[model samples]
Target: MRSVQRVDKCLAAACLVISRHAKFCEGARAMRLLLVTPIYPPTRGGIQTLLYQLTASLPGTDVKVITAKERGWEAHDASSGQLIKRVWVPEVSPLIRNAMFNFAALGALYGWRPDVVLCGHIVASPASWMIAKRFKAAHVVYAYGREIGIRPALAAWALRRSNAAIAISAYTRGELLAAAHGATLPPIHVVSPGVNLPDDIGRCDASRPTVLTVARMRDWYKGHDRLLDALPLVIQEVPNVHWVVIGEGKIRAELERRAKAAALLGNVSFLGEVDEDVKESWLSCAHVFAMPSRYPEDEAGGEGFGIVYLEAGARGLPSVASNIGAPTEVVVDGKTGILVDADSPPAIAAALIRLLTDADYARKLGSAARRRVETGFTWELVGQQLHSVLDEVAIAQSGP
Candidate 1:
């Protein structure tokens, strides 16, 4: 905790001294990389976080980012490292924003002439494809489960044109290949998501047992519906248990209505889109973390990897996850955290009951979760793997 605080203070202070420029860090690698994506910081989301971490620490590489012009986001991103070129094409219609961004990225690609053009988001792959081919750069696409599943045709076109891919998890890789419907797919590097680990873990308050779930509420597969249903039953078992629902989405009003109708107003909290400090506070204070995410009946729109589970684990919090998708890979059945049937209210309630009722056992699991993260899921390790994979692709495709 002390180390993290010191690091935060130092980083914050350095931000004031540093100007957001295109200068390469000393000893920056020889790679000339162009990252094209729709979303970037300070837009906020899992994708943005992953992209930021991946791009922020690269050494010796001439890096440039071309992202969509999201108001209030591009300004803060300069501090994130590399030269940011926001595709600020005006749209006559609001719905055509992506098209505008695509055209802007396409225009910038011809002159930049990067050795490797990576698609930060799957949606950015098409423009990257055109530019990579024209510039003779290795075209690499990132396959996140829903981004491909939602737009199968676009994903297919991008995948076919790309040379390689970076899949967030095995589940995501499988989902992408399945979404392809037998189209020839490129090599997928199964690089699981990582989280920032805390140096010190806050002690859990036995009296006010809190269950934390951080996710976009608009996502139906996130299983907020099932969690809400389980809450009443969970309250029956652990009367003092409180549920903290973090992050905002389209269904916030509906979820609030349901909670109120169920008379769980006081027990439930909706801390929508909290800052890092508040998020850290909640993660530290919370006793147990639960996000009963599941895939739809069509087996679509699921977690590629439960990064929030990793985040909770990193914070020394035990997770209660659904036994669907990549959670089985990230969260152990009993060692780190417990996994229950997806969308099963009874199972969720039972799991929560067990975690909230047994403090010693819950702490044991939390400790193990922390150990798991320390050994396997840190940003350092993830960055190393990602960098190596990208380097391999660039080297292999670099012409004789």
Candidate 2:
């Protein structure tokens, strides 16, 4: 009876404390968040998808987006049901476009004010930094490993001004630290990107071994070339092996030429930039997902977080990824997927053959991958993590 009375007293005291600072608590709960990003969908990229999903998941918060105007954005913005401001940026000159975007983003912050200003990409950070200062809001930057090293000076300057930095993976967090270059840095938090799980798990076709690679062939490090190099070896062991490549880039012609030189025209198909339904269908039907991405000579060019791997995992498809960079954190070697030397064609080929031949082993890994996504990698989890970070910073800045 005495213990129960003591608990009641403690609860009463907690309630009194909460009631005393109710307004502060309310502000924290209904945080006004503004995202300044270089691009948003219908632009179609991992970062764009991430910002959209993360914003959608945060129903309690008031969110607005400032991004460059792209084709089909009006329809996407209307369907999103979120307040979005599109800035006109010319496509001719990189310097002029970037400068215009920064100034336009600044001008867009007219009527409303946000409690937290998020720089969705480093290119937006300078404008975000100025906006945060002008509004007396907390500044946060999303750190993807590759971008930090691309423009080291700008990355450092933006990071130094930010109150906090959110890294998409542990590897990215390390890169953020390295990019600091001895300057005092903001607190870095790792928030790996999430995927929407399919309602039904995909089953692989036993008759034909099919490998799927979905990525823009923008850079050689994306490992589309490495996958091509490995395809011949895979065909030698499992003839009639089919490889489907999705996405479009200038490098597509070069990759096609390489395939023709090897006389792999029949085994390879390039489905350029398909619809969401089509991509999901491929994810469902394919036996394995492979993008053996590697670290290039320039440290700035590499995978920050492989969202497609999670998409495949969500569909109960095992992945073939490089044993380096961000994939090391996303994929569980020997359990969720196979990780191999990204630079070695033989290593990639061997991993593919092993999964293709042993259906039972592949299924085991795929099941584990699906379970991992269910337990940890969901948009709801990302929202919760983001909310916690926002609350912590808001409360700290609001100091009693």
Candidate 3:
């Protein structure tokens, strides 16, 4: 009886604390959040999707988003249902665009004096630093893979002055620390991005196995060429296997030409930029999802975190992520899906064959993958993690 009373008391105290936090989120006194990013919806990708969900989840806070002008953002903004100021930068050269964006951010700093300024990428570190120093506000920056480097001394200096930094993966955090060496940097919090979990996408069509790879053919790192090389081997084992490639990029024609020259054109379908619903439908139809991604040979470009694996999992599809970089964080090697040497054709082929050939194993991995997303990598969970981080920063700044 005494223990039960103690538990009740503790619950009441917790509730009181939560209520106080709730008030901080709900009024004119709410935390003023300023988010600056180079990309956002309707330009969908891991980073944009994460920012969208995280922003949506943090309702009741005074949030302001400053981003570059893109085609679909107007539509997305209409659907967002939020009444925040949306600053748009005109399309131009990289340097000019960054200058314009920073100028806009500078204007916002003087006008609003945000309580916290959160930059979606380190590219805007200088603007974030200026906001933090000019006004007594917390400045935070996010580091994604391949985006951090040594050349931008100014950005690095800005990052060093930030109140905190968020890394999408442990690998990325390590990369950031190495890149920002010799600078007085703040603690980096590893916060993996999340996906919106879906209901079971139904069982795969066992009669005709399908392997889907969805990614824009923007760079060589996507490993589309490697996957194509493995196609013949995969076809040898699973005769009727069909490879579905969904995404559009400047190199699409080149990839298609290669597929045709190799006489594998009939087995492959390159569907350009697809609707969200259509993409989900394809995920539902796929038995296995594969993206043999790799790090660029030229420079510091690697997958910070792959959200596509989680998306595949949500649709009850097993993933075959590359055994490289932070993919290990998303796909649990044998449990979620097989991890193969992304650069090796034979390895990619073997992994794909194993998943498609053994229906029982594929289903088990798919189911496990879905459960993993539910337990950890959902958008709500990501938002909560970010919310907690922001709350911590706010609390520290409001120290008694």
Best by lDDT: 2
Residues forming the 10-long window of minimal summed lDDT in candidate 2: 20-29
Q: If the candidates were sorted by their TM-score against the true structure, best first, what order would they fall in? A: 2, 3, 1
Q: Per-residue error at 237 for model 1, in Å?
A: 1.7
Q: Which candidate model has the greater lDDT, 1 or 2?
A: 2
Please, what are the lDDT tens digits per residue for candidate 1 over residues 1-400? 9999999999976664342211222444367888999888878888888887777655446788888777785458655656888767674674477677777888865456687899987667778888898888899998777777777777778888888988998888887787789987889889877887777777645358899999987778888889999999999878878999998999889999999999998889998988888888888899999998888877456787878998999888999998878788888989988999977899999999999999899989999999999988888888778777877777667633
Q: What's the TM-score of every candidate structure?
A: 0.89, 0.93, 0.89
Show the colliding residue pairs in model 1.
Answer: 1-200, 28-59, 28-60, 29-59, 29-60, 29-61
Q: Which candidate comes out best when scored by TM-score?
A: 2
- Model 2, position 163, has a per-residue lDDT of 89
RMSD value for candidate 2 = 3.7
* Tens digit of per-residue lDDT, candidate 3, span 188-272: 8998888876665675463468999998777778888999999999889887899999888988999999999999987899999
Runs of candidate 1 exceeding 4 Å displacement: 1-29, 89-95, 109-111, 204-207, 298-300
> lDDT of each model, Cα atoms only?
0.82, 0.88, 0.80
After superposition, candidate 3 runs with Cα above 4 Å error: 1-28, 109-113, 149-155, 204-207
Please give the range of 10 consecutive residues that has the lowest summed lDDT in model 1: 17-26
